[model samples]
Target: MTSKPVIIVTGADLAPEALALLGDYEVAFAGRTPQAADLVALARKHNPVGMIVRYGSVTAEVMDAAPALKVISKHGTGTDTIDKAAAQARGITVTAAAGANAAAVAEHALALMLACAKSVVKLDARMHAGHWDKATHKSLELNGLTVGLIGLGAIGRRFARMCDAIGMRVIGFDPFAADLPDYIEAVPLDKIWEASDVISLQCPLTADNKEMVNAATLARCKPGVILINTARGGLIDEAALFQAVQSGRVAAAGLDSFAREPMSAPHIFQRQPGFVLSPHIGGVTSAAYVNMGVAAATNTVAVLNSVREPAVGQQ
Candidate 1:
């Protein structure tokens, strides 16, 4: 209704700081758990110039509905939820707030690693049940152990540094990464499986690497190895993971993301004590919320501004 161009935020909330940056534009929220239909309706209604994706998938259908949409900015690092190919074909740029929540995600990965290594959740549950485990409990010590990181991006590098600081030998596998740190020895995927006491996934999910951690890969890992994943759920095969945990091949697993998000109850992982799960909240910290929102808004504004700018030869 307003004269200003609209920017649609997929979620109901956006940080006030982020809002301040878009004072020239009208911001509309699609509400929480926005479905594809909701996005399509919003796009048709507002014909928004930009979209900030916080939750829900942005399909090709949604993009087709918004003729004025010039850019799609992800509130976080992952852009898998956005149909990038469609955006590219439509000449609509897609961007993400990369490294906006890196520290938060890395810290969460470390916490999960510690939790798995020390049996923290199991111990807590035992204590609450009026049982003592001091006599029989033997926690794994992280010091002097080897940690293999799957990705060496902002989150992976941060986690690698944390592991290195704790006297853990750090090995990483990222063919695309450059400027190797001395402490993190660059290695291949096979070497990581064979050498690591703990394996943490920090890569984005792609067609070639979907369900990369499968039965075959698990068999290559050392027995009783620990696993931590703060990345996409599709990186690991849930069935394979279940079997490994059941067979005691994997000592413990800490998972923040799942193949199907907002993961419903009655899931297989819930029944296993060896599995520690969180509802994809690795980057849900208050600080990360503000950081991601601000970054997303900044990227959105930049793209919009560039589009509005006059060409060098123009008046």
Candidate 2:
């Protein structure tokens, strides 16, 4: 019998269609939230050539256990959970399914903005209570408002176009992009906070960028500004954000990612008013799942076959 190159999938099961695309590869499944010890054991035992990780940290210790592992394919866009420097030093290729969920994330951010602006949650609660409170007039109109986007990458650019189509004045901040759409004025990061009625975070979280949007940055934003973050949770300090919302400095916040997962008991943001929370489902839509899964699988196969360089990281 021919021994197929082994691949381990960490996290939930891949969609049936995504699995079907893998053809005859020998694939193993692991829990979505596997412990470090479990990961180390699995890697040592399976010695898979590739791994598709979602939401689990691929630490150096885990990597060390997997001597035969050649590639790490992140099931989603963010690679913050993985130890990139370690992987690079070991000459193991690391790739993420970047741009695969751009549209889904952009749509989620837009939905958050609308929900916050109109107080959708609160209004729904009031209606359910049988209170005739039609006199409440705390909603803000999104039309003609200034929407500031941080990091004009694939997701950011898509959001900018969507906001522009909705009659919003779109302004962007991306240090790397040389040019932007005519409708999106390329502004300094500070100016984006100052002029924006709504600020949507689309940047990746890195060591230098953790807690990038803290109390100091939040202080620069326009009063009553709406905040939407479908990106990494560590990008904003949850404590500082809670204080800002409590003090009325921030009107509302929509969060798809948080500092912790499952958001079980004792989650900080659960009790906050004017807050909309999603279970990190910004990029988990049906379409997004298929796109990202296919991308990761195809990328994994390519790396295994030595067909091309991995599509993520600097060499």
Candidate 3:
């Protein structure tokens, strides 16, 4: 029997199609919600040549445990959980399944915006309580409103197109993006805060922009501006967001991600009606799951293959 190399999947399972791609390799699971220590243990046991990160952080210690590890592929777009500096130092490649979950996340962002603008969840709760709020309730109309997007990558751009089709004027700020469609007007962060009726985040988390939507930035937003975050949770300071919503500085906020994952019970936001929360399910659709899994697997295989095989001219 041939001894196949190992690949660790830091989750329960991958799509059947994705798994089929790795028939020649042995796959090890680290379970859902794995911690850094769990990953280190698995790496040490499997001596994996690659890893597919679905949950938890991949620290330098985990890398050190897997002496043969050559690549780390993210199951989703965000790779903030991975220690990029350590990976680079050890010459281990890191990759993300970029654009695989773009449509799902973009649609979720739009859903949150509409839910906030229409007071969907609040009205439902009122109805469930046998109270009729139709007489006193007023919902904001989204047509002709300006929406400011923080990132204009694949997900952001997909969301922009949706807003445009809804008759919204789309303005965005992304210093790294260019050659955008005519429908999207490139603008500065100041303009995004000052002019937007709805502000949505679809960017990655980075050191320089941690808690970018803090009290100071929220203070600059237009009164009654609706906030939607389908991106990283750390992008917004939860405490500041709670206070803003409490003061009605922000009329409503729809959050799919939080600074802390698997948000603890009795969270402060749970008590606030102005805040609509989803447990980071923005990119968890059936289609996106398969897409992301396949993409991650493909990236892992490509990286491993490059290292396992020699150049064309080599003997």
Candidate 4:
């Protein structure tokens, strides 16, 4: 009997379709929300040639444990969780199922923006309590609003299209992007900070850009700016956000991710009326889950078999 090839599943949740894609591979799952040590243990036990990694930190230790590991496939677009330096040093190929979940994340961003503008959450609570809020909670129109994007990558470009369809002017800041699509004006970072009515974060978190939405940056934003973040939680300093929102400098904020996951209790922004929080479901749509899973699995298989992987979107 032929020994099945082994593959390790990291922090990101997997759909059955992904497993089906790897027909003969022996799959070993590192439980959801695994730490670096857990990944190392799993790699040592499985001795995998490839890994379908999600959000866990893939450190040098984890790579050392898997001497045969040839590839690491990211289930989503972001590769921040993986230590690319170590992986590259070990001659391991890293691929991402980029843009596989862009639509779902873009939709979530739009939902948050609209909910904030329409006071949807606030009104829903009042209605459930048998109270009418016709007079106090006024809503804003998005038709003529200008929405700024921090990054014009796959997800940001997708969100820009949605904003255009809704008659909202779109301007964005992305140092690497050139010749943007119609209706999106590429602007400097300072322009976005000063001129935008609403700002959304779609960029990856880097050492240079970490907590870019802190106090100094927030001070430049137009008064009553609405903020939305479907990206990393570390992108925004929650303390600064809490203070800004509390002071009404930022009228509302929609956050899908936070600095810490499975968020702690009694967070300052927990009960704030102007903030809408989601448990990082930006890319978890039913359709996206399958797409990302299959893509990641395929990428893993391709690299292991020395086949060229399909063209992936922005990562």
- TM-score, each model? 0.99, 0.94, 0.98, 0.93
Worst 10 residues of 2 by lDDT: 306-315
lDDT of each: 0.95, 0.87, 0.94, 0.90
Question: How much does each candidate deviate from the true structure in C-alpha RMSD?
Answer: 0.8, 3.8, 1.3, 4.4
* lDDT of model number 4: 0.90
lDDT per residue as tens, model 2, 103-181:
9999999899889999888888888999767675668888999999988988999989999998999998888887787
lDDT of 3 by residue, 123-165 (tens): 9988999999878999999999999999999999999999999
After superposition, candidate 3 runs with Cα above 4 Å error: none
State the lDDT of candidate 4 residue by residue for 11-76, as single tens digits: 545899988989868887888888888888888887888988876778889999999889999899
Least accurate 10 contiguous residues by lDDT in model 1? 264-273
Candidate with best lDDT: 1
Full candidate order by lDDT, most accurate first: 1, 3, 4, 2
Q: If both were scored by TM-score, which would come out higher, candidate 1 or candidate 2? A: 1
Q: Kindly report which residue stretches of model 1 are placed more than 4 angstroms away from their true locations once superposed.
A: none
